[model samples]
Target: MVDNSQGHSAYSEDALLVSRMNVKPGGKQAHMRDGWFMRDGVKVIQQMVYPPDHPEFPNEPKGMKAVLAECGLSQQRLRGKCKKCESDSLACCYKRILELQADFQEQKSLMQEVIESMGHLSIFLLKFTAS
Candidate 1:
């Protein structure tokens, strides 16, 4: 007869492994992702502060003046004072977050594939050794 206790122990170990790999909602992983987004947003804002022609931001998107105009904010108005400008800024940040998240997911998928392959190899070795 198969040992029920051994089966149960194996099942518990698998469960633990899965739980460790899964990211819970509102958990530490979520907080870390949010923090990364905030950091990226800050970087975007800092980049916006420089003009496109400025040596420091040669690739900047037409400068903050153009961005403000695109968002329908007058040059004299503060970004916080204009709802459209704030929304546009948030949209830019959100786009950046989405791009980063996609790259992260791709890397995670690759890592998971590697892990699964290793697990298969281990299982094969165990079976070969047992036989």
Candidate 2:
């Protein structure tokens, strides 16, 4: 992993002490988390601003896991079973979600595979003309 510390000194664009910018390592987005070396040092400072879905969600102490669990319980019920009417609508929705996730996973495995199968899936794009 590349050292991406903002550095002890600040300088211009052409400075020699420049750091890496969100480069992926081992084909994965690398988290240059200082937590590995420094315990409890991951706390945010005054000037720095974190974004949504940045692991540390803004203004809410409850983490993403808590948030997602709350949402699933309230919205769809995490067990993928219907809360109201004990209906299979929830199961159907969850099944569709799984199908879409699988499709996306399959597409990400090889870009060419999606291109080869574009003729079948791309039909949705022409929804206006499709009878």
lDDT of 1: 0.29
- Candidate 2 lDDT, tens digit per residue, 61-127? 3321232233232234433312332334433333223223222223221223343467533221212
Flag regions of model 2 displaced more than 4 Å. Answer: 1-55, 58-74, 80-98, 101-108, 111-131
lDDT (10s digit) by residue, model 1, range 1-80: 12223222232211212122211122221111111112334422222223446765443333323333433432342332
Models 1 onward score TM values of: 0.16, 0.18
Instruction: Report each candidate's C-alpha RMSD, comma-separated, in the order given.
Output: 17.2, 19.6
Q: Let me know the TM-score candidate 2 reaches against the reference structure.
A: 0.18
For each candidate, the alpha-carbon lDDT, in order, equals 0.29, 0.27
- What value does the lDDT take at residue 55 in candidate 2? 59
What pairs collide in candidate 1? none
Off by over 4 Å in 1: 1-96, 99-101, 109-113, 119-131
Native-to-model Cα distance after best TM-score fit, residue 32 in candidate 2, in Å: 18
